[model samples]
Target: MSVFAVEYVYAADTEEGRDTHRAAHREWLKGFVNEGRLLASGPYADGSGALLLFTAGSEAALLEELKQDPFNMQNFVSGLRVTEWKPVTGAFADYA
Candidate 1:
């Protein structure tokens, strides 16, 4: 599997929508964590976006998985940036 970093940018004036769906979003992520697909995930302190680390067979597979998120389905995401990541140090060095 390859490691990937995904950034989720929230749409302006969508905090209420995000809050309403937050629980379902988290619940969806929990399944990935249980399957060892998600390494870490959380929102930025400023609340502009969130970052998620994942392991998947390919970038396409990762994108497909991300499409399942409630946030994406609800159109709460204004923008998304996805990139393959190579972790060469710290706790993730082993994966490298």
Candidate 2:
């Protein structure tokens, strides 16, 4: 499996839409966390975005899974960026 960093950027106007779907979004993420596909995830301190760390067999598979996120389905995401990550040190170093 490869680690990936997924960033979600939200516009100011999306707050209301995000709030409406927050419960479903978190619930979807909870399943991945329980299955160990999701390592870490949370909103940015500035409330403009969120970061999600995940492990998947391939980028295609990762994005396929991400399509299930309510935030994406509900169109609450203003921008989405996905990158394969290499952790050379710290807690995630083992995954490198």
Candidate 3:
């Protein structure tokens, strides 16, 4: 398994709109995390965006899974970046 980092940029108008879909969005994400597809994910605190760590065979596979998010479908995410990474010195490094 390889790690993929996904950063989501929120559109101003849709940023605040996330509340309306928060429940469903979390529900959609729960299955992925429970299955270990998602390692960790959360907002950046500044609220401009969020970060997600996924373990997948490739970036393209990760992208396809991300497309299923309720938030993404609603266009709450204005931009994104996906990169494969290596974690060698942290709790994440030992992730199964």
Candidate 4:
């Protein structure tokens, strides 16, 4: 599996929508966490976006999984980027 850095850019004026769906979003994440696919995830302090680290067999597989995210399903995420990441050092370096 490869590690990926997933960046989610929230749509403008969607704070309320996010709040409404936050519980479902977290519930969805728990399944991945239990499966060891999600490494870490959190919103930016500025609330513009969020960063999520995940492990998947391929980018396509990862995207398929992300399509099910409550935020994405609700259109709260306006932009998304998935990049393969190699953690050369730090807590994630073991993935390297």
> Per-residue lDDT tens digits of candidate 2, residues 1-96?
889999999865888889889999999999998998888999999999999999889999988988889999877887989999999988887776
Tens digit per residue, CA lDDT, model 1, 5-25: 999999999999999999999
User: How does each model score on TM-score?
Assistant: 0.96, 0.93, 0.92, 0.97
Q: Candidate 3 lDDT, tens digit per residue, 2-96?
A: 88889999878775579999898889878878988788999999999899988998888888888989999999999999988788888788753
Rate residue 80 of model 3 by lDDT. 93
Winning candidate number (lDDT): 4
TM-score of 2: 0.93
Better of 2 and 3 by TM-score: 2
Q: Rate the local accuracy (lDDT) of all candidates.
A: 0.92, 0.90, 0.87, 0.96
lDDT-superior candidate, 1 or 4: 4
Per-candidate count of clashing residue pairs (backbone under 3 Å): 0, 0, 0, 0
Better of 1 and 2 by TM-score: 1
Highest TM-score, which number? Answer: 4
Candidate 4: lDDT of 48? 100
Model 4, TM vs. native: 0.97
Model 4 over residues 25-73: C-alpha lDDT tens digits? 9999999999988999999999999999999999999999999999999
**Candidate 1 has which clashing residue pairs, if any?**
none
Off-target runs (Cα >4 Å) in candidate 2 are none
**Which clashing pairs does model 2 show?**
none
The order by descending lDDT is 4, 1, 2, 3
Task: Estimate the lDDT of model 4.
Answer: 0.96
